[model samples]
Target: MSVTSAATGSGPSRWRAGLGRLAAGAALITAVASLPWLSGNDPALTVLRARSADQDPTPEQLTAVREQLGLDEGPFAHLAHWLGGLPRGDAGTSWVSGDAVLPQVTGAFAVSLTLMLGALAVTVAVAALACVRTLYLGSRRRLQRGRGAIGVAVLAALPKFLLASLLATVYGVWLGWLPSSGWQGPASMVLPSLALGVPSGAVIGGLLQQSLPAAFNEPWARTWHAYGFARGRVARHALRRALAGVLPQLLPTVVGLVGGAVAVEKIFNVPGLGRLALDAAIAQDLPPLQTATLSLILLGVAAGLLIQALRRALLGPALRDGALPALHAPAAARGRFTRWVVAVCALALLAVITAGLLRDPLHVDTAARLLPPSAAHPLGTDALGRDLLARLGHGASRTVALALVVTAVCALTGLLLGMTAQIGAGLTEVVSTMPAVLAGLLTTAVTGPSAWGAALAVCLVGWTPYAAQAAALLEQERASGHMLASLSFGAGPGYLLRHHLLPAVLPGVLRNALLRLPTTVLVLASLGFLGLGEQPPTAEWGRLLSENQPYVELAPWTVLGPACALVLLSVLALNGADAVAVRRRPASARTRPWSRGTGLRVKSGVSAG
Candidate 1:
């Protein structure tokens, strides 16, 4: 066998190995499916509570409901019966409504599928246009590139919920160009579609901006020009060659789109699968939850399979031609200057957030309307005469707190759930398996779009990536001869985690936490923007945008201030993390500071060579 084939354990062997892993995942999901029975709370009781018109369920009523539910048959027997029926298209009924799970799921799926399709279309259209614009108009033009960067950064950093609200506010409420939030009319789809598609569009656009430009700059481009080909013709040919290369990189964004749909549907009141799942979860309706869970699994698996197929086809061309150079080295750090810029931005963010907390953000001054920066209001006054400075401060506090809370939740959850075996992995898969946008939607369903809901949602969605890192480190450490001997001698999870795992895992865990903060902040601001966060009369960065958007023509500063602050904080968080990570990199490892698994090489709690 060729060395490459041998190294890969290629073809049939690889397939069999992958099948084994797939089966293992299926088995794990099946086991987790049984968790409904394991919970101490009775499904019958929950049903009775949901259905009962009375304030409370009597013991007699509970007993009768249990009898009807066949709960007396023992949990294991009930589970077995439920499992048996699953194959025949019978997923039981809603614990509260007596509706069959299959029908409800099907109905919800139709709506969600439509929305997903629309979102996919929007993503493709926008991304293609963005690519065309960048490739044709912006590649050789620094001004165009810089302008595109600003828009992409803004889109990328804004919270989904916030973006939804802005779309609604301007197009729906202000100009009446479209419906803001609903699924009732065709107009309604525009806002949510844009909201869901824009983020992914930004990602694909950025990748294209990188890939196409690099491809055009290749040595052969000079040869093509030497042969007297037009610049446009050369660019067109280069783009065609680069398409396969960019699509493979875009697969992750496609998958990310699925996750993002969950949140967008909720915000826009689209009666999709995510909304249905959220409803089922809130009602503790197990059948719908099970069906939804399974469907999501299938969706995720399908996306993965699609990506694999695409990669198998197109990846070869890109690989053989070395088309991933732009992908790998698009923006290498510029050394010390980059670090200094990031540090300054971070310090500025800290100062702004801290200063915002010292005063009451809600204190409004009607007399100060449209006031510019003065002795009293550093950020000036809005049309409402609300102190932008105070609001920005309080908003800063809330935004900072939101990020901190999310980071903590993700760190703890990842460490606890992902680092352990079956139980941990299953739990991790279940929670971290949720995309950020979906998590936010589910949180809103549970927490009712309040600030608390946004926080909890961020906490739920942010943890798994880091957790998987910890788990991988644990497995790697355990495989060492000494550790293997210790494990065989009965060293437990706690000992393994503390003695072997921590040294290698701690730095990465900390770095992931820092890296995730900016994302958490974006989500928080988005929730607020959607009106699911803190309600009006409260100053928030996103809320500031929503409030000041109406006065954009009259007093541009109102919209400009909040928008600037939001962008500033996001930029600072990202750069600060990069700078700090750079400061800690070992001499032997000259890779990007933010790259995943870099911390996996930590030696004695420090990044290793």
Candidate 2:
């Protein structure tokens, strides 16, 4: 069945509808792309050009320049010309360099693509493992779910640039296990990828928690038990069905990550597109900027389309099947999936922590320090040199650590503030309206660029979202039967919250937290780019780009690499979260067959424990 049929439950005109949507999307892209050339004479673009130019030319010269750039053509003709150029694989020329735009874009695109693909691979693998184990195998679902929820909250709240800086500090500065900067070889890829992946993992873990419980209630999932299907089979089926709904939501994440890549490339000194984009932005080079932006938009579209395809493949048939009938499965079997998910997550967490602690020892060589990019140093050396590879190894450790720490702090702080405000209405009223952007900027300005200061700023700015979500969750609980139940049991406020309120609000807490990571990462990376991260000579994706700011015009590769890395990391994390969230979301289903038919075997021993 096609998407249209699935959505409308109509006849065979579905394909036509799909085609129409695709056409509309393409039309939008075409129109947007042509705007710069067609409206090149617009006051804003003209003013910007004048401001950037070294010398003020006469109105005649400015008009001539604009006309030569296609401003003389009518909007329709200009758009048509631009459209015609696309068929010849032309992205046009750079206004600044006078070089063919396509070649430069192609080279940078290759490196950026490599970094994104690699980082995405790591993100998907780590997130899948964390989610499956956390949801299916842990001993205490409540505890694991709670911790995972908090982790998501924290990761979402902290900034990505901050995460990158901390990792550099711990692994590069303290341990000295890896090279400090430059993306010349395989060694340079490590820290950036890790920095990109950790926050993503936290996000995926939390999304799984939210979406999985909902899946538990789906009709097909319930029906599987009636067919005596294995627990794993049932779960796999449910998750597949859920992913259909989640992946589209993740598209923005992919776009954001690509944006962050600029900083990640800079910090670790990887020569990817992100770094190039940063340089272009700073230097106001229209060619590279256009290339970077276009590439990012394309990536976003691709990721979005991929998600849609997956959804069609999995969800189309399921929706056609309509609501499923319930099945009676053994309690042991019913709980098996949950057990496995929990166990896997626990083991994975242990492995990661262990790897961080026992990975390797540092071996520095003062003689090899500060090498430039060349045949001897393909990626070149950082300010301190020390073999870029070694710095990366240690840098990975530090980046991962920072992501984790920031995530943890953000979660704890957000939760506390949220819960406190929920109990204290006056505080909630005041804090709820405070804007995150303002708060973040103010905090950064006040604290400067140290790791602690950044983290504090992020946490403070990020608290508002958590507080809002929690306050709403608490208000809902305040009116529910559970509130009366706790009061009747003589449970004190703390006891009631611990026993009842927390569990009810757990799902939303998890969802919001996971959703926050990519945003935090973007903010942090931008700040770093603006020189608000760990102090100088310290390699961060943003800082790396900053160091190479001078050469962006000549050597775009330096900035492109790290910027791409940053973007990929954020996208993967967000995508993973979206996938998990979709998989775990509720499907239309009636109650379990047995529960509905008898409601007898499961005694109400405790409403909630």
Candidate 3:
């Protein structure tokens, strides 16, 4: 048999792997050490330099000042010099605060890390509980499944930002259960964490609910039962088996939460990494922006990689031992006509929703000379003569485009990196959990408050999630017996992925990206409202809200119009995603393909001979 050949012969490959790891480590270290010089041109530093320069006595003194800061050196020279100094444990001084930049950034990171961890903890706990209930509440009955699906649909359809805002307003603003608009102590973390975690938890819940039922009903689960295993043991083993399916989807969910937490940071005035990113971006500080972006990327990559590794460990031996079998054939063909009807109905509803925003009917007193909702001007005119409806259509298009851009960029990068095997589990973990606020801060600092710049920043920070998720799926597939089937037929890694792995993982990736679209749009809008995206006269939804804040008392429609559009569009996109998942159920779950006694026995006390 060629079994040993597939599993053995690795000296050269091991050496090559070692070399690659060394190279990656060196590059990351070099990037970290030189970040100060790279990000030194930030507006804050420029102002600091100018201030320091003005106080100088002579040309010699000015030159000396430049020399002292290594401003005279070229960027490469400066980076090298900084890298050289880092081995001695010196990260240099911040031009703004005259403090060590490393320590300050690290301290800021510590605060942000704590917040991220807390939020992640909350999400995991909440999601686990929700998923467990959805899975075990009913005995695999059709009605229970329908209710669970409906719950997921409702949760998925709501926008995270709108959810957070509403929760903040109701729980914090009205009830005063938690402080709103600022961070103080641990108490401040509760509301934002809930707001961020709930939507994320719901996402996890949906995936688990979908995966668990099939996993439990599989032959393996039946085998465990046949062995006289307890229900608890069967449930645990089934969940563990199902988790292989769930982990890949989680990478993006966590990253999305990172983005949401950024908005929460701003709302609550939390000085976490998300806030740092926001501040940096708003101030156009390039150095901070660069640092923040790199940090976020690394964190996200590391997180993703870790998750992938866990999936590999769980799914690997089964593949090597020829236990897990390859799936054959596509899923059942859904009703084409029904799908078309649903799509058409959705489009029609979208049109009606657009008209409601555009056309408004209200009474206006002629003597007041005030514009009320009327046929001549629907939704009324904003402070400017521009129709709210026209602006909204443009805004919706822009929002959707930006969301798609972020999703596309992230997805493509992830696929490329995953295919190339460049982004491993360790890298994803280090990169994906990055503080959204920090990325926003750094980007605004460098890019000078433009939407394109924000989009770029979002892409840079967001790519890790998709990459991590894709890489995890890739590793899981490779560790399954399925990869061996491809190899046995003489398929190369690339061919195997394209023909097998890609098809398996693409559905989950696309579903996740679509689900995340609304949230990304809301993030862009929040940044815009905070004066971090488009400058005035650009007419962005966020910018519109900010401009009309004062007039909110007299006429809230200006602010409400864009807000409604944002909320509605976000909800519509999420609904579409749930619909897609429901329509195209995968083959593995539908047919129960795995043999009862053949696949590796889960640790369910279910003996298989």
TM-score of each predicted structure versus truth: 0.64, 0.50, 0.72
lDDT of each: 0.58, 0.48, 0.55
Error of 2 at 159 (Å): 2.1
For residue 254, model 1's alpha carbon misses the true position, in angstroms, by 3.7
Q: Which candidate is the best by lDDT?
A: 1
What lDDT tens digits, residue by residue, belong to model 3 across residues 1-609? 233222221345334434544455455444433444445553334534544544325666545556666665645665565556656866555443455556655655666666667767877876687677645642232213333443444454444444566667678877888887666788877877776776677667766665565565556666676777777777776667667667766775665555436656665667766566555443333344345445555555565556656765666666445455322112222345535544654675477357645533232234433255567656666665556655565555566677788888877876666554442433444444444444454565456668887777677656655665565455445544444544544656566555557765676567567666755665666666566676766656666665565455466566666666554554455445555544543333332212234443222211111
- Worst-scoring 10-residue span by lDDT in model 3: 600-609
Best-to-worst ranking by TM-score: 3, 1, 2
Judged by whole-model lDDT over C-alpha atoms, candidate 2 comes out at 0.48
lDDT of 1 at 36: 41
Q: Rank the candidates by lDDT, best first.
A: 1, 3, 2
Best by TM-score: 3
Looking at model 2, residue 549 earns an lDDT score of: 47
Residue 577 C-alpha lDDT in model 2? 44
Candidate 1 TM-score, true structure as reference: 0.64
Off by over 4 Å in 2: 1-4, 7-80, 137-144, 172-179, 219-230, 281-288, 323-514, 517-609
